[model samples]
Target: MPLKKLTYLLLTCLFASLLTGAPAYGQRTKKTRAQLENEKKRNLEKIAETKKALENAQAQKEVTVGNIKAIKEQISSQEEQINLMEQDIDLIDMEMQDIVSAKEGLETKLQQLQKEYAAMLYSASKNSGKLNKLSFLFSASSFNELFMRYKYLQQYTENRKAQVIQMNKVAALLRERQSNLEGKRSDKKRILSAKVVETKNLEDLKTRQTAMVGELSKKETDLRTEIEASKRSVTRLDNLIANIVAREISRKNKERERLQDQEAKIAKNRPTKQPAKKSENLDGAETALGRSFGASRARLPWPVQRGFISDRFGVKEHPVLHGVLINNNGIDIQTPSNATVRAVYDGTVKDISEIPGLGKVVTIQHGEYFTVYANINQVFASVGQKIAAKETIGTAGVSSGATEINFQIWHNTERLNPESWLVPR
Candidate 1:
């Protein structure tokens, strides 16, 4: 009966450790929430921007109706974000459920551990009585036998005490797990609310995109010099983002190295056991790249103030060449004959130069993100200079094939669709 109880005790411990061994996920989930919230905040900012852009988009009253399949992509992206958020909420729900279930089971586990500990202690105490003690030395007939029996009894006593201590420790752990479980349940509730909010916002985005398509369908689009100018701006922005992200990667590597060393040292004190598999590493280089680009989203400001979007974002039939379609990463905001372009956000100026066909351009780096305001007649900012939000950086000029301000967003050399970010005008 005692052996059966001990086997059950060992099995219970093994099961509990397996269930609880995952490194704390709460902090990682919090970071994910922060990133997603940042994305949502940026997305909402885009809503305000698109509203503003839609107001000015009215300038080009002419609209040409054709296939509008591209707007579907924007809608899809928004839906995807919403879907991902929903999945996150679902995962949180499951995790919390497990924690809660574990907690509910903990009271029984604690009672069992305590009872087993007491039983072990009581059994050891019984063996410690003088009558039992006498058997250790007296049961042996030879001197050598006596010493061996005594040593065996001493080891047996220590083993029993150790079992009691281990059981007591496990009981305390069960209580701690119970507290953590309750806290996780509360957190899951909040995430559920956030998921609902994101879902509604996604549906709203689709309606707005539909409206944009309807308004733009009347105009015949043209992309002459605009192509070259937009390309130059995008390249510059890409360079800036790459540089900034590279620096960030370097910094993160240093930090990881420091922490890993500490983890290695701490590992020595921990008992050998199977550790839980970690979820996706959001801190990895690939994930960071996504963050650097997609994370920038809609917080960025417009380059030209008081301009009509003479051209919308995406692929269009070349204005002059009817058979040819030109792919555009962004839109053209046509201002008065001479409009001074400004920095969209606080950042370090990375480039200030003129390209042959693109005219003047200025690029700025903001942490791991970058922005370019190009197709300028005059450049005012210098490389390596720190610039603030809305600071006048240059004067608009003819670049690529259009006389309009060309803007682009980049993160670590990857170009993100500025159409998703910039105010739609």
Candidate 2:
């Protein structure tokens, strides 16, 4: 073959490989339509839940700081949903751009393939007549030349047929690309419409939040009085928990002494000098309960499945009262009205009592550790009744027009931060 023809063939092969071997660089990292839709669904669910909580908070005729706070939280959740929708819109836009670019590339490739096919057809037409083709073959100078002419004619016809096939393949690919681009453009339009609706909803929530805050701000004196009442309730709860812990410790100590006396009597009757193992004489059930509860720290289920911590454990500046510090031994979880309060762990109810400011309270004992659930309307578990983990103990009571439960954990006499022990919300 001529050097020029050999070089041309090599270049064509290289170009074909370049077109076929192109990497899909951004395909793996890009989020699919299903993934984006799933995220939007989750955000919508969250907004709905927040709305329900707000409705429950506003059920009472009188408005309180808790109600205002719930409205503010709902506003926050709506804002998050809007942000997520914005993200979805942005992703759709990016995907649309990519589709447009890919379609343009495919169109350009199709045009090139059509031009190549047309050129081949024009060359074939120029040598159209069979008489002209026969004369050209007869004009060869030698037998070898004639054979080369025949082979070249055969190869040329095959090349023209291959070019036509290539053109059809490119046309099909171009059509597919166009279809995909249109679909993406449609998706972008829908996403933009959804975003507009979400944006309007977000604005409405903000307006409501502002109104709630303004209403609460005008009642500063009433808010201060409520805070004082809450402080008194917290104090009474602390005292009650302390007394309960003391009584429980004393009871456990007496039981330990009795067990020791019984072991001693058995040992005295034994004929062997070897001492009995502690595990053989001690109550395994009592010891195991404490160990199991302790082992479940940071893994314990929430007392209420759906709620937010309105008041966290430890001392902090009051939300409404300036210069006032409120100390919390346990977290205050605010939930929808009539929400069922469940036990965090398996235990026996130790006491059921009512304090001056707070409502009904239930204390459960898991060996050495104790759990307290307060601000409840009705109790389902009585004193000395065995309770299972996540079993409903009572219905949450409304306080200041909002349902809030005070949850606490104690190991013997030491009070623990319930937030640290409970699973993250």
Clashes of each: 16, 0
What stretches of model 1 exceed 4 Å from their correct place? 1-81, 97-122, 125-150, 201-374, 381-404, 407-425
lDDT of 2 by residue, 265-335 (tens): 88888779776755353556877999999999899998987787666789887655558787878887788
- TM-score of every prediction relative to native: 0.44, 0.65
**Candidate 1, 34-127: lDDT as tens digits:** 7766776665444444444334333534322211222333345456566656766676676676556555565566566667667766776887
lDDT for every model?
0.60, 0.75
Candidate 2, 334: how far from true, in Å?
4.0
Q: Model 2 misses residue 89 by how many Å?
A: 4.1
The collision pairs in model 2 are none
Candidate 1 lDDT score at position 62: 33
Off by over 4 Å in 2: 1-43, 56-61, 89-193, 246-269, 272-278, 281-283, 290-328, 367-369, 409-425
- On TM-score, the leading prediction is 2
